[model samples]
Target: MSDFIAEQDRVLLERHGLASYEALWALTLEAVDEPNTERGGWSSVYRLDLGEQAFYLKRQSNHLTRNVLRPFGEPTFAREFRNIQRFKRLGIPSLEAAFFAKRRINTERQAVLVTRALDGWSDLQGLLESWPRLPGVERGEIVTACGKLMRNLHAAGQLHGCFYPKHVFLQRSSGGYAARLIDLEKTRPLLLGERDRLKDLDPFLRRTCAWSDDEVRHFLTAYLPIGTDIERWRLRLDARRRSKEFAVGAC
Candidate 1:
């Protein structure tokens, strides 16, 4: 029995043909509507539906280096599971993990993770693709909100290693817009360093190529006040733009 499988979910997993830890490797998965990048390659992810409930299954194959360190380091699936709980305890919106399992396959390691789906949410990147059309004030509000959320995460001593648009989800509810972070495999506690914290800004800046200078200015101001090394961040962002590493597409 996999200890990570929640007791309430065990019967559901069995009903879906995942009766054992090893079964996860052979379980047939239905792909959800997501970018091709999320499909099977180095890893496989699926959207599982059991009656009215929805969940996500993510299985990853570890590299040789990671396999070698299995004894000393926690598996990716375990780390993500812990991080999800940490985010929730810190009052940061995120999904809940229902199951996690890890096993060695010869020299390589394989792992599986299961989480409840974040329904009624859309990625921030998709929203920003229509940047040219959104009202200025609304756009500013989203930018400001995202900046504040990121600041809070950093202040909590956690680093979202992949701080990209696709990992950030936003939903409009009766109260207002709420933002949540996902894909937490790389999340970890922050050590003592400014560079690590600064790295979080890169992905946001890269996704803003479609934004006007005024929008970027507003975002930075809301993120960190003026006279707080704003120019330094701008220079670093511009350098990435010049390099054309992550091309920002237009709508």
Candidate 2:
């Protein structure tokens, strides 16, 4: 369409031997200017203004780290793809991810993951950094949303390996409150009948004893409820714990 988008398409095709996200990438760059003011972490966040579709584009920088990996630092990009697809299937209220791109320049090959981007959404970590004490309806909404998110993830056979490590942020949405799972790069879906499914809790439960009883209670409260299907969660959580214990004793 535009010269910029067209040029990007060409570069992507030539560099990565793939041309999936060229237009999307161009759209992000075109909508952003030095004056727009961008906010992000180490990853390059492209500020976009698509009228009613305004967003802040996210992509993994070729050189970036800090709890963010290309999913176990694996080149497949399958983890990221599966998460988006699974969330969409579970009807989870999350930022929509679009196509991703793979590109290379010279001897270095790089991957570019693209998503619809978020404009108003804030991660739980950021929100809690401001409001630690969630009061009244906010607290209930947080509990509900947290439980729902976790349920959806587990239903999709995914284990979110980290939850702020005992104390993380909680996001307060306009209509309700929610908790954002930090370090999503550690996510892995339990493959059906796969033995590795039992190993999924290794990362999350490794420091279980580090969690204070109160902290653990708070998390369980947020994650378990009759309406949210407490029985299912308990079964899975206990199964995970038992698997870890057995693995340790076997060695």
Candidate 3:
């Protein structure tokens, strides 16, 4: 069994008897989402509230992903935990893992990951729903922040495999809006150059229907270098969008 508890959260988790793999795996809490039972394995997320603080606890059993590095299989949460630490080291804003543990019992593998809740942050989807009511400056601030976050992520040679609006979170900060990413289970190193950027950005553009052409241009302005051909990039994205639409329609 291997486990890690962030020093700041050690006392609280210890107090709740959740400092070990067995304790966290056996914990019962309100589930936040439906269990994902895929690849003959299962995973679920739960909301754990302790006093005024809140945390998210994720549990999985035999949920494995086979890769070149680990041809056999490894717990998905293990990858996620490593990515969380990597993001922190790279100065990327992301979830703060409070505790992470994994263990093997016979042929079964189980893992748990806990992260502190972003108390004041709101998902980009929720913020977009109220975009009309927000001040123009605030909207621009958020768009710029989002663009910068993406630029930073890509520049660091990391790709957020799933870059949907819901996975991007924002909070009002002293400078402006601060952006953070979550649901990094699919995150991997960026390869194939610009193709990797398109892979991540396409889905985000498709899902965020609230953005107008002007808003998109503004975002790209913030994302790209001063002399880069933004229109060409937009064309490529549009072509990809159409291909996606056609694929879905054909299905």
| Best model per TM-score | 3
Misplaced by over 4 Å in model 1 are: 5-26, 32-42, 61-75, 104-108, 225-251
lDDT of each: 0.73, 0.46, 0.88
Cα lDDT tens digits for candidate 1, 1-251: 25587777888888877756678767787665442332222466798778877888887765222335365544556677778879978877777777887887785667778888877788888888787898876676677767777877887888898888888888765555677799887887789556677667776666656777877777677677557888787886667656655545422
* 1-94 per-residue lDDT for model 2 (tens digits): 1111234234433443334555544543633434311212123456644435443544443432233553334323334545655666766555
Model 2 weakest lDDT span, ten residues long? 33-42
- The TM-score of candidate 3 is 0.93
RMSD vs true structure, all candidates = 4.5, 9.9, 2.2
Better by TM-score, candidate 2 or 1? 1
Winning candidate number (lDDT): 3
Worst 10 residues of 1 by lDDT: 33-42
Q: What TM-score does model 1 achieve against the real structure?
A: 0.74
In terms of lDDT, model 3 sits at 0.88
Question: In model 1, which residue pairs have backbone atoms overlapping below 3 Å?
Answer: none
Q: Per-residue lDDT tens digits of candidate 3, residues 128-147?
A: 88988999989999899888
